[model samples]
Target: MTKSGNVLQKINNNYDELSERYNFTILPRSTRWNSVNRLGFSSTYLIRQGRVIEAIEVAELYTEYQPKSWQAYESLAKAFEANEDNLQALKNVKIAVRLVDNEVNKSLLLAYINQGDRVNMQLRSVKSLTLICLMLFLMVLTACNNDSKLDFDAFVEKKLTDFLIEENAQVASIAIVNDKLNYQKQFGEFPDGTKPHHDTVYEIASITKTYTGLLLAKAVVDKKVQLDEDIRVYLQDGDYQNLQHLGKPITLRHLATHRSGLPQDFAYTSADIKSGKAFELFSNYSEAKFFEDLAQYQLTSMPGETFQYSNVGANLTGYILENVYNQPLSTLVAQLITEQSGEEHTRFRLEPSEISKITRGVDRNGKIAPLLSPHSFAEGGLTSTAASIADYMQYLLSTQAEEVLLSRTLLTETSSEHGHAFFWNTYEYHSANPMFYHSGGSIGTSTWLALYPKQKLGIFIATNVSANNTQGKLNDIANAIVEKYEQVGQSK
Candidate 1:
């Protein structure tokens, strides 16, 4: 490891210890300033230590801790540029450019602006050359120029159609580019010939974990919770007495990264699932019951010693946040994500008017399926439209929300090649600049969220029907779309 990497690892190792030592009894303005400076120092240290993703994450935390500081925004912009997210880099630098009064930093920001402009100019030139070549080819091969105009709309439509046909079902897809949603399409139809509308909602199973992750990051920003603190602190003294793994208490970070060693579900039996009633299985599952079962649970390994995907772990984090914020998970999600991002159609509990927009899931045999309720609300209970999910994704792509959402926080060797964030899994698409993604599946529905932070690009897909290979289909579609954009960029 590089010297920077060594320092970063050391920071990670001592993070909890230092937090407990210094900020345990966080007081008034002075302590808050001290906390902000500590975060700023960490952010700068990551940058100097050459940990790009970690730097970006901590830089974002610094900005949240001190939003008015032009220096903080400037630092964040540099981090974005270092990560090759030139668009966001330019955006932040421009903000910093306006905020700074002194000439020194202003000149530095202007230099970054100029460099960004040069890259944009090259891209524009490539696009123009591509258009010229296409025109020339069409004119020369009038007999065989099969519409080489690169109609992104048609390309996406065909991909969706092929995917739905392969799965033998129906799907809803929305595509966003440059922060604006430009395409909305539906494939196949219900038995009643009811086509999906723009507002069609689907149960976005594990994608709900991303919302929980957001709430966790938000709670940290609000200073209501800390990532490294043992979650037992939030519960009553004896509620989770049996929750520790060999003497190590599970922290929120472990839970979010799926290394808490907690099991994937409650002790609910197969009989509970066979009951054919949603509430009977989990809808009304109470937090008290959750702790009751947790008190009897055993760990497979010590906390943070292994990567074990755990729905119950995420649910427990949500429960802890509820304890800290004194609000339901639904309300916290609305406040932190949906309302904040203007995603009007995403919620755990839907209003009466919005109920009709739900695209009921279909089984493998093409029959309408029963709704699914997971072990807890935080596990897999949120519903959203392609547009609404796209809106939330747009917020992420915009880099206007929490940077923790996009940061490469964990280095676990998951099925995905890159790593994992809180709930988002990272994949190596075309470069070291890995793409972040998360897919969800319930009884009869599937959803996917993917973004290339470096490119400031993303795609959202939600389908009402679930098949054995739906996740593969979603991956294929997302990859194809990203490749299409890369091709366009290369053409320019």
Candidate 2:
């Protein structure tokens, strides 16, 4: 076996030992490896390690052993490029993208090669070029998330009490994006609980995944990527799995919707995530690491089979987006979602550098903890005011400018979006009729948003601390408001 193959075997063995703790899932046959794209795998590792020829040889192997594997072909192209063999790389990339058939991977291959050298692919569109932010912006406009000038700005400051602020919650800014609005709110100290300020940020944990979901959708619209294709074609070459047991051939859509069968982030202790701490569990993880782990993850269920929440699954979605854009996930957020969402005021980190610009997260106990960053923003690494969060909902729920910024064609089946997390769907609470929305919570922050597209109604709330039973309280509040809106709508 090649040294790379040997290392993979050792890693597999170590992972097997680690699985003794939980009920381990067996790798499926389709994903099972034996010697399909050996050339592609070798070439990929070599290129990553800065070795050119070995990488080329790796790509060549795909042509020999697994003539069908696009991974080998893409690697061949990449290896060629690294070796300055641009011609060969161009020749193979065409075969790779068509063969692999994944949107993100196709984007990656496209990004790696030059236009003149490309093998006969058609040009992409302008709107598709800026799909993430631009597409959503247009899609949301259709939802009637339109905002009106608020005389309440004066009311909030003049008629309201400083209750949350006096309790240590720092109120940042208030913004309105149509019927949805967000407030800039922050609270408590920094890491280890020190003197805190207004701009203290908090790790958003799983919220990062929601943003990743949006990116997936945008990629589809851009045509820079597709969601209905096999994932192997987009991935770096290695041994095993040839799409036989991929559960239904995991697609970008499946991954975005959390049905791709990837696991949540590696099961690791908190201390292990920290560097130099314990040779940690999730220590070897970053975007690249995420894809590697994904290649090994077992498909407990088939694609679109069922709903199972997994961080690693979501992380892979973000990772794929990054691979296609040739930019970091954080950068993608800044350019696409953050900029277009107009939640530009919102930042994705858990620090207290800005005294008047951050929000603190609280748990069920309502106790404060340290902040977090957008490193995992694809899951939950964002802090924003209730108003800003609501504004985001506008894009999701609005019907006014559907075809403009928030296209109606994007989400026709509301039920598909309603399953677990974000995506407009109805759930009942406090005997209130169905309300479509999502909730977010962490160490010292509690956020809730509700949108009734049918009624053109919405509500947003973000607290610096989690209210143990306040969820019921918010539900009560939301239902009450939604009910009132319904009654008013009927009368009209």
Candidate 3:
């Protein structure tokens, strides 16, 4: 019997071995020619079945069924490939890959295409090489399973993608490091399906805070700034004179931890936006303007009183850092994120200007929008690619990077729960998990970046669909992926 047919025979025989949901494996079992998730079983199915007309049906579903269920789509692509519609097949496959999250399945999908070395080679009948290669990839996934553990690489892919799909969201990329003797994989988009490439950029809304927060962590360790020092002391400018008289001081600790009594976002005064962009929040940015902003606004609660998640407070963090470093916040981020992390594609400076390259925040209907305004650079100015952000998180997992950016004592403080930071917020410290996390958003943008330092797991998820609050969606996906990876580690 052909290897493809044999491999299918074996998987069908032992389908019970696949992990379901949290266990990380999702190998569907079935009987007869119409095996369930058979499209996922092997690439051989495609060489024998790919055709064109059916592929169009899948594209139409992008608008109809939303972004889920890739099997119908992959089959359509397979039909196209079988019928010699290679270009059409490639195009259809892009959408299919986007719809899928299962790592094992996506890898199986790529088996036939990896034959790009001789795409021009013609075959009169079904080539035997295809069957051999296709079966091997399947066996590889099956082999990675030991006792009951799922493949680490596949687990990351499936969990994250499943989470995003669950959120009615999609991630452009999920960067991972699953060393071989295991799977090492990457999934998702760039400007043009490119590689070593820029496809993973998504509008990581609040994750912007994590980048700035890391810089603050570094600064506190450097002794250039103290957590307890009044931010007003750092800023000699009269623009912050209102802060000088707030009855209580707003310290760096309060700003970083978000315990300072600040609003979540700027609920600007009529004078500031009466005739201007009412929601164009960052249009009036200047040190003096900030003081005016502070003086004109009333403190809803006492400073440093309780935990409130104030974007205003976070932005103030950016301001304090910039003021102390004597540099622009974005520039500092360049040194902190890109230079330090050895990342090349990540940037906050938009093309020729300053545009976030990840997913640009989305509008009401999940259309791309802009994150144009923030009063200060530190609070919300960084825009990063998933790969770069993931790399940065991996850096935090390092004792080497930690020693540079922080002292053990300050790192403890940054991760500590100090009651409240700002607007109605409570910090949940995950000390046991040793997670470095932050969520961010700006109008139509949202993002989540987290790292389990001890576990050596880092996940950065960004979606282009903004104003949709992709934070929960991003985390759900990250958690799913992390769960799979941790399972693999524990199984070891």
Give the best candidate by lDDT: 1
lDDT of 2 by residue, 1-492 (tens): 322334334435654442332112322213213323333444556677786765665456456443435666766767776786544555576566455523445555554443524332222534324333432443343222212112233233331224344334433222222232223323223446564332233333444455666666566666667767776656555632833254458776566556666655564445553442322333334655654555566665666676555666666666667777778777777666654443434556434455235555554444554344323446666665444454455555542332223321222232533443232223442223344555555545555556555544556554555545533444554455445434433212
For model 2, what is the error of residue 355's alpha carbon versus the real structure, in angstroms, after optimal superposition? 10
Poorest 10 consecutive residues of model 2 by lDDT? 142-151
Question: Mind giving the per-residue lDDT tens digits that candidate 1 earns over 232-322?
Answer: 8887647566668678888888888898888777745556656655436565667777888888888768888888778899888888888
TM-scores, all candidates, are 0.65, 0.51, 0.58
lDDT of 3 by residue, 284-401 (tens): 5565666566656666666666666666777777777887889887787766555545454555654544443344444556555555533335556555665566556544554366
Worst 10 residues of 3 by lDDT: 18-27
Q: Where does model 3 exceed 4 Å of error?
A: 1-171, 177-199, 239-241, 244-247, 267-288, 350-358, 373-376, 402-431, 467-469, 490-492
> What is the TM-score (0 to 1) of candidate 2?
0.51
Reference-based lDDT, residue 27, model 3? 32
Model 2, CA-based lDDT: 0.48
What is the Cα-based lDDT of residue 140 in candidate 1? Answer: 50
